[model samples]
Target: MKTIPTLSLALIGALSLSACQDKTAAPEDIRPVRYAVAGGNAETGGARYAGEIRARNETQLAFRVGGKVVAKLVNSGEHVKKGQPLARLDPSDYQLDLAAKQAQLAAAQSDLAQQQLNLKRYHELLAKQFISQAQVDAQQNGVNAAQAKANQARAVLDASRNQTGYATLTADADGVVSQMQAEPGLVVAAGQPVARLSQDGAREVAIQVPENALEAVRAASSLRVTLWKGGAPLPGKLRELAADADPATRTYPARIALPGDSHGLQLGMTADVALPAQASRQLSLPLTAILDLQGKHYVWVVDDKTLRVSRKAVEVGAIDSDNAAIASGVRAGDKIVTAGVHLLHEQQRVKLLGQ
Candidate 1:
């Protein structure tokens, strides 16, 4: 065989090196990934939340002024009518105050009478030219001043009488006492709640709904309330829903108005609220598909055509052990990585495990 030229050998070596690099570069490393299709969540019968029976209007009865409680007229659970006295504070100080105000009024009235006589005498003297116009004018002004002082004293006396009346705590409306915080010999401050009065009117069931279930509660078609003592469910309607969630419980307070004659549903009684399942057209995913970072949650979504995955932020609600209901983010029919999500990365090539 004839030996190849050195230049030809160099050319063949370069071609082989180029072929090896091309082969390595053309074959990409593809990862196998498992995914599941997201769709609308299933509807259960209803979501049950614990709640309590309450009155439509429950008022806290507090004293308008601070004083030592002298007597408690009503016991807990006692029925009271409008303007009925429930408790009494020591009225000795208030009595003294009223007496002093009356005394001041009397003194003012006496001074006004004397000033009126002086003014009349000055006017007569002016008519006869016995006094100058300036003297008469000054006496008239003094009389006006005395009359103003008398009016002020009368107003103060009326206010003092009102204060004395405040010493007796009376019910503003017909209601039943639910609680009593202060008793005889106990000193209470102004605006301190002495009792809780449940007004005799419409009744309701108070329920605390979690943040995730708040919308469901609001969208509920109907509600059923069952007493904890094992009675038939009573039909209830949504009366009020809190605009904000409680900071500590992260739950919204909702009130369901019960029938006026909801038998056996008394105030402060425990009850169970049942909200029927709501139909939703939003997609849901397994909790394992989501990754929580910082304070937000995200998911790995797959591209159907490209077989690649990208990180997507998602808004989740009402998470259970296996799945989480999606409020926003991924839509219906979107494929999400269900397993080995943490091992995946953004914009990474992937191949379906069963494909």
Candidate 2:
């Protein structure tokens, strides 16, 4: 056998190295993706959230001024009429202040009366040429000054009288007392919640909705509220939806307005609020599956046999924070890439991450 040249051996070695690299080339990456079957969410009939019955006009009742509470006249759950006295503070000091203001006002009025008499006498003296015109003007100025002081004292007396009334707490509207926080001896600051007053008015159901369901709940035309006390579901309308989410719960607080009768719904009663579902048989997908490109909505449809992903434009109807209803462009049985859709392209091989 003839020995090969050194350059040819080197050339053969390079070819062998290239072949090995080709054999070890990274397998075409088949990205693993999380997916969901269309219309697979079990709560499709309606989304029910646990909630509580609440007053549409609940308010915190507190005193305008700080004082020792002398009495709490009502208990929780007691119905009260407008202008009814609910509680009272010690009014001894307030009354004393009012009396002092009265005394000040009385003294000021007496001084003003004396000043007016002096001005009258001075004007008569000027008319008889017994006093200079300048003296009459001076006396008139004194009367004006005294009158101003009397008016100020009168205003102060009125404020002092009002303060005495502040010692007693009265209901601003007809309502039920849902809670009482002050007792006979409790000293509270001004504006401290002494009681919770649920004004008699329209009733409501208070519920917390997850971020994903916020929009759907807000857009709901009407809902059914079932109290834990076991009665027929009450009809309600979406009244208020919080714009921001709660920090601790990460959920939005929503209130559904019920009629004034609402079958005598009691405040703080546990309840269930059910949002109306979408149209019959309409498929919905997790909001994550939606892909919006150039103002058009799309979704990644996965082929079962080939495990390949194909981007398809979809008709997106109502969309909540959690899911979007599909009007067209996909079927009920089609598998959809729920997550990692933005990272995918047309006709890409994929692996299902167990549903």
Top candidate (lDDT): 2
lDDT of 1 by residue, 1-355 (tens): 9999999999999999999999888966678877878773564246787888888999999989899998999999998999999999999999999999999999999999999999889888899999999998898899999999999999999999999999999998998899987799999999999999999888898889888777778888789888898867888888899999889988899999887674566778898888865555546677788888899998888898998899999998755456777888887778888888878877889888741
**For model 2, what is the C-alpha lDDT against the true structure?**
0.88
> Highest TM-score: which candidate?
2
C-alpha lDDT of all candidate models, in order:
0.86, 0.88
**What TM-score, to 2 decimals, does candidate 2 have?**
0.68
Q: Tens digit of lDDT per residue, candidate 2, span 146-190?
A: 999999999999999998998999998999999998799999888
Specify the poorest-scoring 10-residue window by lDDT in model 1: 38-47
